[model samples]
Target: MLCIGFDVGGTNARGCLMEFTDATAPPRQLAEVKERIRDTRAPSQVAAVMADIATRLVEQEGVDPAQIESAGVGIAGQLDKTGNTVVGAPNLGWTNVPFKSVLVESLAGAGFTPPVRIVNDLAANVWGEFCVGAARGHQDVLAVYVGTGVGGGVIAAGKLYGGHGGKAGEIGHSKVVPHGAPCGCGQRGCVEAYVGGRRLEERLTQDYRAGRSLGLRPYLPVELRDVDHMHMDAIIRPDVADAAAAAGELYADGLWSYVADLLAMAIANGAMVLNPGLILLGGGVLRNTKELSRRVVERIPSYILRAAADDIEIRFGELGDDAGVYGAALLARG
Candidate 1:
């Protein structure tokens, strides 16, 4: 059987075609395609881009569209209980959008129809890691991804736990400070407010404009020095990490270190509560900065309960950028 999976984000939508037999066996990737999202305001537009990516993958693989038995979408957003509607996606500027329906319509229009499963992107990532990546043998796992924003997913007792509202693993929104930095979610002091890539860029921009000397400023483009906000073309988390890494001693006391500390704190708090056997961290930030993971690991024991910290194995995700797509496809196959 064949399954199609998609990982849609604010910047791009990636889709993959995989062949799978059952849940026990791993899926084999046949083809993958990615499309940059030009317009994210409309759900239909993004759905269309995903549909096109799916179509292109099938074509690239020379597989019959009819061979696809199921489809899965890992999207960045808060989903309703049914998982059909995106309650809100701050990065995409979406509110109460029937994303699954729009995607289904778009796929149908593209001459493809398959039962689609919609899940939070982090959930898909965790599932991927659980099935075939770093957490392969772990029954209880917590997966956190720090990119444009921070997101988390949990697998408890060998099953995905969605909680009463199907939003169980939103560790990003966990409050870190009272009345601190503002988050895109319209809240204050969220872990994401301090560590998310977008938030970090915003903070850097603010600090630069305020005449605060930053180690990262020299590494940034000259034009960004006078900019009010860091645009897409400006320096990102990976660039910032590189700059910090280059400045040996500064890496320890720089903004990236603070970001790592807060993220570690959030992860520790989550570990104390969930007590998962494995804690897998990934996403653009962790992937780009290897030192951040070590820093986070070093701080975990201090913040987490001793018992919880003792048994937990913290590691970076193995699947890199393809975790979501692989997980989504396997989940759809099941």
Candidate 2:
């Protein structure tokens, strides 16, 4: 069977063509393409870009369009209960967009017609991990991805668990403190406010501006140090995970350690409620800073209940950036 998978984010859209026969085995990648999203606010435009990428993949691989059985997209946004509409995508500046319909129309225009599935990006990542990555053998799993923002997904009793509103596993917004740091979600004390890559960058920038001395400062570019205002491009952006990793080499006991401790506490709290058998942590932050995950692993046992902590296993994801694409393809197979 041939499947197409896409992982659409705020900045880029990535698609892959895969061939698979067995549900348990990893799919074989035939072709892949990526494109920058010129404008996130227009759902049709983004969908058309993805369709173009898919078309290119098929043409690159010399595959018959009729052979494509299904396609899936893992997108960063709040999806409606049916998963056909994007209720809101803060990064994409979208609301109540019929993304699946737009994608279908775009694909049809590109001469490829197949059943399409849309899911939360984190859910796809977790599904990918559960199916063929770190959590493959675990029946109950929890996955936390710490990128520009923190997000999570859950698998319960060997099935993906979408809560009553089909938006479970929003661990980032779960409050860890009362009236503490502010989050982009308009909430105070969210876990994301403490450990998310964007939040961390903001905090670091603030510290630098206030002359509070950040370990991340020395590793930053000379131009970044002289900036008087907060600018995403001028500052050490979260997408550049290597800067955080570099700072950690000499300052393991600084702000990064504190962030790791807070993240571990959040994961431990999650474990207490979900009792998941396995926990998988990924995303740009954790992937680049090995010490961060190490600190999280070391501290989780201290926060979680003894009984629950004893049986839980934690590991980083194995698929790296490809988890979403792989998971989407496997999900389409269903």
Among residues 3 or more apart in sequence or in different chains, the pairs in candidate 2 whose N, CA or C atoms overlap within 3 Å are: none
Among the numbered candidates, top TM-score falls to: 2
Give the alpha carbon lDDT tens digit for every residue of 80-121 in model 1. Answer: 989889998777888899888898999899878888888888
Q: Could you estimate the TM-score for every candidate? A: 0.86, 0.90
10 residues in a row with least lDDT, candidate 1? 228-237
The Cα local distance difference test for each model comes to: 0.80, 0.82
Provide C-alpha RMSD values for all models, in order.
Answer: 3.5, 3.1
Candidate 2: residue 115 lDDT (0-100)? 85
Compose the digit string of candidate 2's lDDT tens values, residues 1-334: 8989899888899999988766666778888899999455488899889888988999999987778898988999988988899999877888899898999999999988888899998888889888878888899998999988899999999988889998999999888888989999998999899888888777656655565545455556766655553342454554333455534444434666677778888888988999999988998877766766677889988899887789899888998888898887777667
